[model samples]
Target: MRFRNLLLSAATCAAISLSASADLTGKVTFSGKAPEPKQIDMSGVKECADKHPDPVFEQTLVVGEKGELANVVVSIKAEDSPDLKGEPSKDPAVLDQKGCMYEPHVLAMCVGQPLVVKNDDEFLHNVHSLAQENPNFNFGQPNKDDGKTVDQAPKTKEYIRIKCDVHPWMSAYIAVFENPYFAVTGEDGTYAIKGLPDGDYTVQFWHEKLASTPVEAKVTIKDGKGELNHEFKAEGAMAPDTSDVKLASMTKTSEKSCCEMSKKVEKVATATPAAKPADAQVKAAN
Candidate 1:
């Protein structure tokens, strides 16, 4: 009886150890020279233009002075790790529109995660998503403090494009994953994904400018710690958005009432420039 009890205790300890989670630290650095900032003509929207006394540069390819690449999404491709699936966080994923730009520029969230979109700008803005895997959504937030909670969670791993129909320059991307092991690189190009069980994982790094890059790495974690580092070539790699926004062609979808905005948005999207390729469309940097 004593021997059996000891064995049972050992098994319990082993099980507890196996269920422990770890932290994964990563950084995405840019190689070669940083790209020149592209100027955005915000004149079309006086409200947005007035906010910027000088020129407002595009964020399509933001690189730090020391080669730090911002807005790069780093996520674990846990296709084989069924047990590593994490429960969706009760806190909703936030996407804010301020100063005529999407804050964070790139957002990564877990599948089935709630999304909260807020318009912090005084000017009217619309949140329109060009989502393929998930059902599409388009809504207008006219009031400065207006915010809408997107109750439905995305059911698939996809990169959804969020745009403002009223301000064509306003764009952002949301990448959803099966698990919570994802992080968006900050301005310093550093990211950390925590709460990963000990195992092998395929980490995928994605950026709007480096859409074609096979930015993936395989790493094995043990003792609750792992590190990943990736570098993207910045020489002629920054894909700036020089496309012209023909406001004349894009009527004021925001002006329409909530009931009629959806119909007008559909008409406006059809007239916009042909969408970039699927991978390229994952995010809009500029």
Candidate 2:
């Protein structure tokens, strides 16, 4: 009993230490001009007909000349980061379905934490996480007013697509990072991470739309506080509004690509995957 108590105490401390935050913030902007969407009229169109009548190419938002960037997934391995906060985040992540749209369209919740799946919609909907990084959950929510919570296995992922089968059009992505130090850009394009221990480390920048060459960067960071600006030039990157946001950069030291998960983390991945990206139509970064 004493040993068990000691183990529990150690786990609790690790959880709290991992939950500590280090303030780091910045903006992601594009150099090229933002393309204006050309709305095409399909007055006379039919595919699925009664089920799916007028299908419009959803307008996507991308980084522009002024550079509006958000949802750049960042991750760093504990080995790559010396004296780093190696423990994962214990906070619960909320993914709510309301009015056929997923709130917090892009999320960066840590693994092993409770993922709160909410449904405020008036219709029955199911959550199907097309996941490879974590154990997949594909259950229906027959009730609308109330919702359910699910536990997610621990794993490092680029991003996983989630949707409601009943409402085919509804979609969202949960970008899970093994490291606790990850944040999603906001509307104005600003991100801040704090409470970091002093040491050398590498940080990554991942954009869903804009594809940068390096995929990730190798940097030696000292403790205290530091700043680095990462600009994703639209001209060189994938059109934000058109294609599936591809990989940008990573902090991997080996020859693997920036988007590739390190072997240390990949060993924890789920063996089988469930669904793929919905519609083959990619959603733009928020």
Candidate 3:
């Protein structure tokens, strides 16, 4: 009986040790010369221009003096780790629109997590999502402090681009993952993904302007800790095209509703006769 009891106690201890979790910390840096940020022209919107007393440059690529890269997303690829399934957090991730720009230009969240969007600017701003995998949403926030909660989370892993139809210059990216092991680098270029179980993981580093594809690295977590450091080449980095004139042609305002345009199109189609085939017309003429 004494031997059996000792065996049971040993098994319990081993199980506890195997179930322990750890943290993954890392820093992302830039190796080459960073690109110059373009100055945003907000002179058309008086309210937006008044908010920024000084010139505001685009945040396509932000690098520190020490070559620390900011706004890079660090995540554990779901395809590589089958056993690292993590529950989504109950708290919602907040994205705020202030001074005609989205705060935290890059956001990473787990699947089934809620997203709260807040508009702090006094003027009208449209929240539009250009998601191919998930359902797209486009709504207008006319008043200040207009907060909307997007309760439905993405079912698949994807990088979604969010933009403001009213303000063509305003844009942001939301990265959705299957698990919670993802972190965004801050202005200091540091990121820490906590509560990860002990195992080997394939980590991916992604920056919007640096490369079209994500950089991958292998990391092993043991004894409650793991570290990874990566550097991205800043030379030849390209910014996303956000031409106001091109985007304006694709957007429709509330003044010209979709139903109204459809009715006009129907009337025009009814008035115009269909053209006969070229062969039939030639036979008739002969």
TM-score versus the correct structure, for each prediction: 0.74, 0.65, 0.75
lDDT of 2 by residue, 86-177 (tens): 34445567888765557767777765555778877555678887665467788877666444678554365446767677665565767765
Model 3 clashing residue pairs (backbone): none
Quantify all predictions' global Cα lDDT against the true fold: 0.63, 0.49, 0.65
lDDT of 1 by residue, 1-286 (tens): 3432332233210112223456677667777777687798988878898889988887777889898888888776666455455567666788999988898688777776678888889768888876666777888888786558885556787766678889988878788777767888999988877666556776667776664232445566655667766666544455444343321122111122111100011111221211322221111111
Q: What TM-score does candidate 3 reach?
A: 0.75
Q: How well does candidate 2 score on lDDT at residue 121?
A: 59
Tens-digit lDDT track of model 3 for 33-107: 776678999999899999999999888788899878788888877787765565566677778899999987987
**Top candidate when judged by TM-score against the true structure:** 3
Candidate 3 local accuracy as lDDT?
0.65
List runs of model 1 lying over 4 Å from the truth.
Answer: 1-20, 212-214, 235-286
Question: On a 0 to 100 scale, what is the lDDT of residue 107 in model 2?
Answer: 73
Better-scoring candidate (TM-score), 2 or 3: 3
Error of 3 at 118 (Å): 0.3
Worst 10 residues of 3 by lDDT: 277-286
